[model samples]
Target chain A: MLRKLTVLAAAVGLAFVATSALAASTKEEPVAPSAPWSFDGPFGTYDQAQLQRGYKVYREVCSSCHSMNLLAFRNLGDKGGPFWDPKYKSSVENGYVKAIAKDYQIADIDRDTGDAIKRPGTPADHFVAPFANEAAARASNGGALPPDMSLLARAREGGPDYIYSIVTGYHPAPAGLTVPAGKFYNPYMQGDLSSFWKGDPNKVPVGGFIAMPPPLADGKVSFDDKSPSDLKAEARDVSAFLMWAADPKMEERKQTGLAVMIFLLVFSGILYASYRTLWRNIDHH
Target chain B: MTAHTTYEPKTAIERWLDTRLPIVRLGAEVLEFPTPKNLNYWWTFGGILSFCLATQIVTGIVLAMHYQAGGASAFLSVEQGIMRDVNYGWLIRGIHANGASMFFIAVYIHMFRGMYYGSYKAPRELLWLLGCVIYLLMMATAFMGYVLPWGQMSFWGAKVITNLLGAFPIIGKPITTLLWGGFAVDDPTLNRFFSLHYLLPFLIAAVVALHIWALHVPGNNNPTGVEVKSKADTVPFHPYYTVKDGFAIGVFLILFAVFIFYEPDALGHADNFIAANPLVTPAHIVPEWYFLPFYAILRAIPDKLSGVIAMFGAIAMLFALPWLNTSKVKSMRYRPTSKVYFLVFVVVCLILGWCGAQLPDDAVIPALGKTGINLIDSDLNSYVWLSRIATAYYFAYFLLITPILGLRETPLPVPDSISKPVLAGEAAKKD
Candidate 1:
């Protein structure tokens, strides 16, 4: 009976942790529900089909506001990238990537005229910004700056999970909660809503007001593969794409990690055996 | 000295060089040095630390080649140029970043192992002091290294940590100004930090050589804390310790590799990915996990000057440990009471690290969190009070517990020599 009671107590404690963690952002910020991403564990690799769909979400929806200044057209076809092909050893030489690069206009200097000109982008060109500068972007978006998406997946605590959660986490403001002008309620966001809350003093609600309204909706970006294009799907795809942008070397890192781990383990075994053999003649506890 | 001199130069060329340098003889002496047979796995950390230092130096040199120290470009150089554009730059950068954390892990264990075995006592006091100097140099190196990326955390962390000197009266402001090279943490500060970060590692290497020299003078402290009375109590440094330390290092490298590859950013802050913006500040700013205990101690006191003093005092406690511990019995193995206290001290330090990461005003027990029973400004059940309690215990463990326990506690009867326990067990088995 005592053991059963202990087990019951443990279960109760674990349940309490789960509910409290997900229910509200007390001082502990709300944890994003982890999505099953293709790239998560040590052996995990990015799903190319999903990444391709993800690029569509970024280009069609997210690109109008957010910028991926660090990403180049060549990067889209680099080894382990979405458009990568074994046939094209160099990402710049990939025909698909070249075509994609040619679709966009890149800001360039006209060599002869020495004047700024917009020309067809090459594979080497970086992704262009939606707005010319931070001020212009802020002015266009209700005096709130849209953060660059180049490293956004990495900048947040939960990475892609946090991005997915925020994009899909919008909810109707609780009756007692007050949202400031041009702000939307997101349960996944981190903030203190005590002043804005008219609810019970003990219950100030989870999450905070975000400047960006819900950007993802059902059928937001129709995928080429005819995959699901719901709010969650779009959010998940875009989050994955951003993750690729943030950590392009993850595949190589993981692969090298496996080799290093194996070598270390085998080397350790040899060393341990040698240590045992060397100490055999001695008697030191 | 039954063995003949193995390193006596036989060749004419070797004999000609031996009188002038004899570096080969130095190696021979080091490899053949007598070490305590009973030294445990804890002794392996010194070897592991040597490896850690070498890893940091090599990886750091490569990272410096590619890293741009300018404030505006530092983040880009790291995130885009190195991580993406440069070949295998991600691997190099990850190893260097994670290597710092690994170095601290090994050093902390090595230091605590010293404390538990009372390796800091008697003739080894200077040795302990040298080790302390190396630790100080490591922290300085790490702090400056963290500032090089010029990210949000890098900028603000540098700003906050440098401002710590300003807690001192009179000379504080000037020192802070001199350190920053400007009124704020900007490009100039980044440049200077990059230079110093490169410089401090070499200084750590120098101090490490001295640390080893000091160690060679006294030899290693054993688990029994009994001084070597005979040759039977010791073993040669080669084959015995070499293989043992090598095995331990292999194990340490596994952990280091896991962090570098699979979990590269696990030890780092996400805020560091964002470029430094002077106008914007992160909601909650905390130091790296390694510095959390000191951070906790700093915040435990309400007054800024007192907090700063208390934080530095935490490290000063380490230097004063050998003198403060009054026990004739060195190792905690003999002192059961001290063993318990030592365990508590370890836990207290961990609790202090947790406290550092948390908001001071947050409730210690979440159930009683915002009760508003303000005991001197904040809630009675808050982390602030918990931290204060932990800080008090942290000091008391060193200042009060060690001296008092040494005098009062009846310790277990210790063996006369390192080999006594081993021989006694063998004798009992024979009977």
Candidate 2:
């Protein structure tokens, strides 16, 4: 009888343990992580000239389908400008302008017709999406909405490196590699046949393989009195411009961080000296 | 230093591990003996819960390495991780994704153990309250984390939850805008949520430390519903409880590993696979399964504002449980009548969870006409009446039965000794 009771007690104890264990299992689901790419250290900072060229690439080609609606026209004239030089602010203002009506409605109009109503071209304007509606947009672009490019440089898995790689890394299809209809493949994407020919498979560019067709062509847009630049350089420059657009304050943030650190160090030294004097008499007591 | 000439380890690796993980031997020391004489297995949950938390933190850090914060790329970044990049990025992502479900699973068990053992009674009330705060923070963190993916479910879930704020009085619209960071849930909202979601877990860890600290002060309540009276009744936590907790944690990990490796997406919504769209809404909107009971409470009310308030109120009411249940008795083992009611309460909660998952039309009508509760104007009358009945029963279990049972019900005569109870019943019959 004693043995039976002991067995029963043990069984009940095991059951409770099992139930509790099962309950703990419920809490084990993993949360997805945010922002995998490292923006710090050695690989940081894009070249300024590359950014200037990338801006031109954007203006000439990618801007047709994508919108930088979050950016102000005047912002292009700031020091280390993402789009244009400081002297060209007036020209940029004259080139594209937004007019607000009496009732706070913003209208973009033709420069020729002073009274003509127009869509907004200001930083505050909602982006003019590529498609009119979901159905129409999908129908036009093989079911993929050409996403807004305003934050694309910062938003993808690889940050700026991904954008740079995708733009400059496109190549002609290798022998025996079949391209899917309406889908343009980038050779630098991992797992693609051209990925092997591009060099070591281990070093494919960031943001993984892309399906967007190549946007730049040799001498597609040219600047007069140019001091030797290739289409690849132009592509790299445009990507840098997009990166600045995505995070205009990044450089300023780094500078501010350094200033704060210096101030903290100086303040700590003063405080430490004050503490030493204040505690000096206490030790003798 | 003068008396003892100790030889230092020459290797850098030895020095590092020795300093950082000095408790390795201590961990083994704790895992070697018998637990307190009266300690039932309910004590095992706290250790298991800690194990799950560690898993989440580790996996969360790895996932953060690849995640993108912006609206445009957040969804696609996850897809890239699954399709390319990093050797076992997919496995890591899957484990982290499923680890959330496992974390909640452990907490619920930890919570229910507290409830069943009356761990929340008397001195432990503050501990339970801290636990409730932890639960609330965890829910917020999970909800915000889900939005980072920017999938169909993420978009709609944000919309639905944010819109709930609009049900408030005059200031509702402004509050909703403030919460969304704009006219609608957009880039600003995503950025801010990412920042907060990243921050809240650290806060949760801090609160959990307090929760455990509170538990230690009163020590642990046991199954006998009696306080420790002597040295014979109690045991030191190490050696005895450590081994028991270790064994329980091992079993828990096996189940967690199964979900991580085999059926990673089993608990997730399929709609989340699609990228977010503002214009389109999915056919159904359901919250994570762990939230189903409260979700049911929300839908149970016919009015939008009332429904919102009622759902929140259900959770808030748990705070008053210690004062409301004037039960002298701690465990259900002693209270015969209350035991049956507690079982029924569990069943009701399960039913509510099931109903929460189904379409509103499929909610059980409770045989309304036969019950003679007249439905004069609307079909909603039936639902309202049924919900009121269920809600009444739920409250009554706490307020009336608990206090009444404590005052009036005849409790089973408790054994004087823990071992005696086990030996008394069966041993006599065998003789």
Residue range A1-285, candidate 2, lDDT tens digits: 364345335433433443332232221222222222223432244455556566667767886566555555544544455434444444244322232112123556667867768553553344354455656756766765665665576544344566656666666654444566766556445442444245555443332234466777778767443734566656556666776776554454345445544554555455445544543442110
Q: Lowest summed lDDT over 10 consecutive residues: which window, candidate 1 chain A?
A: A17-26
lDDT of 1: 0.86
Docking category of candidate 1: acceptable
Give the poorly placed runs of model 1, Cα more than 4 Å off: A1-27, A31-34, B1-6, B370-373, B422-431
Off by over 4 Å in 2: A1-285, B1-35, B363-389, B417-423, B426-431
Winning candidate number (lDDT)? 1
Instruction: Quote the positional error of residue B60 for candidate 2 in Å.
Output: 1.2
Per-candidate TM-scores read: 0.94, 0.57
Interface RMSD of 2: 20.4
Candidate 1 lDDT for residue B116? 95
